[model samples]
Target: MSADGGGHLKMYILIRESVPTGFAVLAAAHASLAAYLKFRDAPEVAEWLSGPFYKAVCKVTDEEFEKAKAFEDHVVLTESALGGQEVAIAFKPRREWPKAFRFYRLYRS
Candidate 1:
């Protein structure tokens, strides 16, 4: 653990420029180095975040930010109370994500 007792495991909130309605949360566990992310449609991930297993989400890393291109594995159109829009979230396993190098550190969001 770090001096603050903060493990390498962390959470970040992801909002896509394409779908801005909601946020995606990414979670990394301390011991196992297992990363879990939150997605609206992926009930398993949502359920995991709903429990105490989550460390943090929606965090802006201390390092600089790297912009990612907009890519859609799947898209959905929503009809929420506010308006008709599409929103989605993603959880990334460590293996599935690439090293996001910013100012000095690596980030997933």
Candidate 2:
């Protein structure tokens, strides 16, 4: 929150889940800086077969704190380098090939 109590960056993450129970929510935030977090244990086939999924709970409160601090101080999301995600995830845009010639034209005697 700012002097007037307003957040700068808001984020929404998408994960696959389906259960008769209910919705799942999670977050971690700082006093006035930033935050980040994740939600899981949806009880879907994958969740159960994968991790014995069940009812979830809040793992981190005041989440956005870290992200807010990072933006305030201009830090990068390199935690993936540490252990979050495998690096080297590069995207090379597809190249368009040149148009093909309809037919060959030549002079003959």
Candidate 3:
């Protein structure tokens, strides 16, 4: 649920801050689609597809990127153009998230 306990669902895409701006945007898009394919059958994904569908793209430090991997319902995206380096992570849509997620900085140029 949202902070207000609504029925909204959201997916989160976290890109490494070190990635270039253009690559970061592509990474977020790639990660979103990949994560959706991976979790397409999930009830949460279905519910999200039925709703307005919200997403947050955040810039993460290297440490935060590692920490994001601790979540189970996520897809790690490796950029072949970047020598196979991991560039982003996309979490499955959910009604709620860990409190720490609220602190991630939004991706901004």
**Which prediction has the highest lDDT against the true structure?**
3
| Predicted candidate 2 versus true structure: per-residue lDDT over 1-109, tens digit per residue | 2221222221211111210112212111111111111112222223333432221111112233222233221212222323542111111111121121011111111
Per-model C-alpha RMSD: 10.2, 23.5, 1.7
- Of the candidates numbered 1 and 3, which has the greater TM-score value? 3
TM-score top scorer = 3
Displacement of the residue 60 alpha carbon in candidate 3, Å: 0.4
Point out the worst 10-residue segment of candidate 2 by lDDT.
Answer: 86-95
Predictions in order: lDDT: 0.29, 0.19, 0.90
TM-score of each: 0.26, 0.15, 0.93
Q: Which stretches of candidate 3 lie over 4 Å from their true place?
A: 1-7
Local accuracy of candidate 1 as per-residue lDDT tens digits, 1-109: 1312333322333333333223322121211122231233454445544554533222222222223223222122232533643332223311123333121222233
Clashes of 1: 3
